[model samples]
Target: MLTKAGWILSAPASVEDVRLEWEDGSPPGDRFGEAKARARRLLPWRTGAERYPAYSSALVQLAGRSQLYDGDLYRPTAIAGEANGIRLRFTHGRYFEHLDTTEILAYEAASRDLAGRTPADGRYRRWLKDPFDLTRRSTGLGTVTLTIRTAAGSAGFYMHKRDADQLAVGAGVVHAVPAGEFTPSDIGLEAIRADFDLWRTVMREYAEEFLDLEEAYGRGGRPLDYDHDWPFGSLNEARESGGLRLYVLGVGLDVLTWKPELLLVCLIDGAVFDRIFADMVTAGKEGTIIAGPRGNGIPFEFSNISRYVDSENTRGAAKACLTLAWRHRAALGIVSDVDS
Candidate 1:
């Protein structure tokens, strides 16, 4: 029978669970360990790039402020309650791309890389050149002044040009007055909210599937009759498969954010797993693999066996786990040893 704690632990056991956690806790984490752990679990399976491709609408607030400054700027704004404009200026030879925009292809254009001549003629041009004009005929968006500078001393602004039609689908517009004139208001806050919500959902689903796979695989090994009341009992069941079982554990935000690449590393090296298992035992969270097998009816115990150590060993182990997950992006769907 699944208890309340089991259900709570299992709540984020799958990708779908992770998603629901995020939806309930926008930007989560402020609540401390609970909300943050859910967020980290979901991050590995986030479809944020797919849902909010090109640029996040949440960033429009910053764009609104950008217009107040002088020079070439790429600011996303709404216009006339009908279209969204990504305003930007070109400065030097380099161009900027939108975070939401997907890069499809890149190829070298003909030689237009000179100081005096317009680089725009070569399919790419420095923003500093005067009389620089480029048009996205399909989107009805065009560029006029090529060279402009910000007070901060930045040389160029890059932008992702989107069609008015595509921009209208994500958000609505409001009215703002400036200098005695009225202009359409930018409400990208909604877009950002929606994008984040969608990402949370994707992460939860992934966690669920991962747990399911782990259970199915465990069943294929040995069957150990273990206590259902104790959380540690599940560890004994996992031992039949050679020290493997579904165990649900929480991780920290620092580990998730700064060491995202570590997920990929652990997956590649089995030794990383050994280190983590050892650490858990040392932390006084010991359990067994079978109850009735031994003469005293105790389970098999595994210990931390690493001789070579360092101050950052735990950090390294965490990084390895993160690296493994990242490397096997597809394997996130596999069953997790963690219960729930």
Candidate 2:
């Protein structure tokens, strides 16, 4: 059964051994910066990027600092899988996302290495519960377990699915053999794991970029425009700080993309617009968006930004639509309507 299960050889004796082999030897600070840059580069494709600038700006204005980390308060990389069906593997030292009652039982069962060599009947039953429920209820979600067997012994990992996919998708059983044993069949799982870690580091860095932009804007007293290279920086900050204020005039679909459109009629009306614009100019900052009865009027509705997507497929598609709106904000009168 073990051989039929397609399990491979065990890994090195200790996690430290794996780390020694995989550590990039770079300073943590520099490594973090590089990771953020990569994440920023990928932002154009993700909705998080578009919202990040505004969210971070708001955080700065209200909280005085942008959120740098999720502060999940649990070990990172414990749960592994796509949206659902995520399995947590804990024995290998990864501990994140608190576990719930069901998962706790499973952990106990797996720990016992029971008579059947899997999990006991009751524990196995809990394991079968919906992974989402287990995750949602639990404070910490565990890791996914993979067992590999070889001539020497058995090894496993509580690793992310992406890392597992990278390995399993390849042609052969890739073992991370120590410096001594070398074979084509032997691939280093540590290398793959390191790659996954690097990817996450980059994502956090990208988040920080927007956070910094928000800080700079808030410090400038919520400017409409700044000397920054990105023209959208000031406006993005203002929207986030609630200084600009967004009013939904109306929502409709773009005939081409089938994506939603949010109409902006104007920033400020007569007296309010003049007052705020003059104040901003005097403060050496550009003006902000102020829409209302004088500009667009009350009950002016725009597409619900938060309800943009309902499912994963639509999530990606909706983002593509939003990207179009962001790029064409000026040409389509969105910018003029708001900024004017």
Candidate 3:
């Protein structure tokens, strides 16, 4: 039976029970907060790119209505009213339990090389358990495509171009925003055994990438008018339009980082979304909006999926994400066939 502890994957004798253990091996340090702060400072450029001093090691996957469809096609699972968090426990033998310092460094190096980026400098401490290292069972990072739907129910997806400082996976290719790993800050260390906190990652990313937390807070204003603390509460009250709908699209393996990743779709009221986008794209607010190929500003800056799908520059897991988003546009509630 599925319980708070974990769901049963098989009969008792043969399968291991869902388990949660501290990655005691993560290089000791209190740099998690500092790393997060630095990444926050970078915004869309390298948000969460710095190798933090340490982080909680946890596995993430779909559950309780969210499921992977045929490996490629994304069947988005939508949940509303309140945030839905999926808690998954691994009973498999492949999830690594421990790693020596030397092994951790080697994994980090390989991860950088594979992603076509430089090794982590001393900016922040390195996460002992590298999710990019596919050799080991890395933490499951979640990437979300926040969709803005018009009053007419037509949906628009926001994709950004990766800058030089970011990983090479899709450097120039346009891809979704508000994506990152599920760190301990997202899922509390104490509660790791009870839940994976998937939705929390979405909310946090939404605020950071899409809403610009620093500016929002600077104005004594909160995105979505959300008056809450970290690991946010129910975002339903903050919804501006028809309401917020979250869909667990599918999973894609990052060929560059060698980590398993989850792609999610978030639908919000178009009017509210446009207002936020407008605020960021005004004449003096260029940097506030992330631009890419084709154009370098707001609505004009957003690229169509078709234009980049076949481009040689768009490759790797990001390419997979673009293809999936486009393939499932109709299922994702996108109404405009012309734009899709």
Which has the greatest TM-score?
3
Q: Over 4 Å off in model 3, which ranges?
A: 1-140, 166-173, 186-195, 214-234, 238-242, 275-303
Candidate 2 C-alpha lDDT tens digits along 178-220: 0000001112343224323311221122122212222221112
Q: In terms of TM-score, how similar is model 2 to the real structure?
A: 0.17
Off by over 4 Å in 2: 1-97, 100-106, 112-114, 124-128, 134-136, 139-202, 205-340
RMSD (Cα, Å) for all candidates, in order, is: 25.6, 25.8, 14.2
Better of 1 and 2 by lDDT: 2
- Candidate 1 regions exceeding 4 Å error are 1-13, 19-187, 198-251, 255-318, 322-340
- The lDDT, on a scale of 0 to 1, for candidate 1 is 0.19
TM-score for candidate 3, residues paired by index: 0.49
**Best candidate according to lDDT:** 3
**Model 2, position 175: C-alpha lDDT score:** 13
The clash count of every prediction, one per candidate, is: 53, 26, 2
Q: Record all residue pairs in model 3 with backbone atoms less than 3 Å apart, i.e. clashing.
A: 52-125, 53-125
Ranking by TM-score: 3, 2, 1
The order by descending lDDT is 3, 2, 1
| Local distance difference test, candidate 3 | 0.37
